[model samples]
Target: MEHMEQYSITIDGRTLTAWEGQTIMEAAHDAGIYVPHLCYLRGLVPFGSCRVCTVKADGRFVSACTQPVTPKMTIENDSEELLDLRRSLIEMLFVEGNHFCMFCEKSGNCELQAIAYRLGISAPRHDYQFPERRLDASHPDIFLDMNRCILCARCVRASRDLDGKGCFDFVGRGRGRRIAVNAEARLSDTVVDVTDEAIDVCPVGAILKKRVGFKVPIGRRTYDLEPIGSDLEARRRPRAAAPTGGAS
Candidate 1:
């Protein structure tokens, strides 16, 4: 078999090697560089709905999650301009929905909250749009709270692509957009299970598993001990030597 050619790109002055077909975000993650994102899951298709991953590549701003890397390409991810853009996006999400992270079950483990914290967004700059969204608790083991949704479509993609069940989809348009189950009836009538990838793919508290709220307790959840990008930082760090013999 012939070997595929590997090339390098310069991201924020750091040269990193990348494969031919890999996107900028994928290459950055593989190189232990954290690029903030909401809709770009590792296995799922890059939805690029959330513009949080926007970065300047070769002086052109583009969604890093969907933009492929080219050799010697100049990608600026950590620039002040890009960081401000990400912060603004996070802030917009906060105001667009009723994301009361303090009272939500997915607070600490929520990707939206984690990203907001990472971007230093203490509050939304824009006025809150506390739209009157509905909550569907008819499901036996799950709850769908539209108020907290960011419309990232992670659930929609996961349901259609991974679950083999087109149970979820985006309905309406613009400010009226929402996720709708195929049943068109109550959520209990739908075929979605608690174990569905769609449930796991939700970035916020919009879709939650019932009867397990506060199970881990506050200040002890996923992002409690460390920030969202801490894992990437750890991966970038050099590993210490292992002792040849048993512990002293």
Candidate 2:
């Protein structure tokens, strides 16, 4: 396929050009506009459920990842209206489930945590729905905690696309919906390969290394990188591991 040419786009009255076929977020990132995002990963397809990256393009608040650019498209990435919308979305994420970042192992290194900080959401404005969930520490290398999962599906995609192992899937719907390993089976027994890619693909600490916990401090953590794309690309490196035991 031919390389797509750069096209002009006006976001927040600033006109800039970006390569065709790149998502709105990619274009904005190239133009030095940081769109608040949580579910977006560099090497995977954009799943916009987190809604923090919504931008007002052509008078509609659409996800920058799912929405492609068009000629003469004007977007408002940081207007007061969209900022309020983003704040509300971040608040929803905080109250939807157990996102206790302060206690999470991936607090400083988490995308959701970073976006929540960027949105200035000090605390959840809505009621907290702390549902009961079981933690899966059966895997020798990693721990799968349902409590911190926001159903971003980045790990699922990483398993399928990058690792060639479709190990993760969303089981149930709405409040009942959670990422399950191996068609509702245990993570240790899943036929899919659980490489370092699977672990790093997670936006939160839902899937974490078993032995290594909080080795890096908050301020010196990986999220300190200016553009998240470079960090994400670096994390996608697949590390060699011994044969994993049965799925948990």
How far off is residue 212 in model 2, in Å?
0.9
lDDT per residue, candidate 2, 1-248, as tens digits?
45455567888888877566767887776555678787777668777787778898899879987788877789998788888888887787777768777678887788777776666778877898878887988777779888888888888888887888878878898778988888455777876444558777787889888877888865788666553445433433222122111111
Clashing pairs in 1: none
Candidate 1 shows a clash count of 0
For model 2, what is the alpha-carbon lDDT of residue 139? 77
**lDDT at residue 8 of model 2 (Cα atoms):** 77
Q: For model 1, how does the per-residue alpha-carbon lDDT over 7-126 read when each residue is reduced to its tens digit?
A: 678888988777666788877877778999998888788888999999999999899888887888999999899999999999998988898876888989999999988888888899
Q: Give all candidates' CA lDDT scores.
A: 0.85, 0.74
Model 1 misplacement above 4 A: 1-3, 237-248
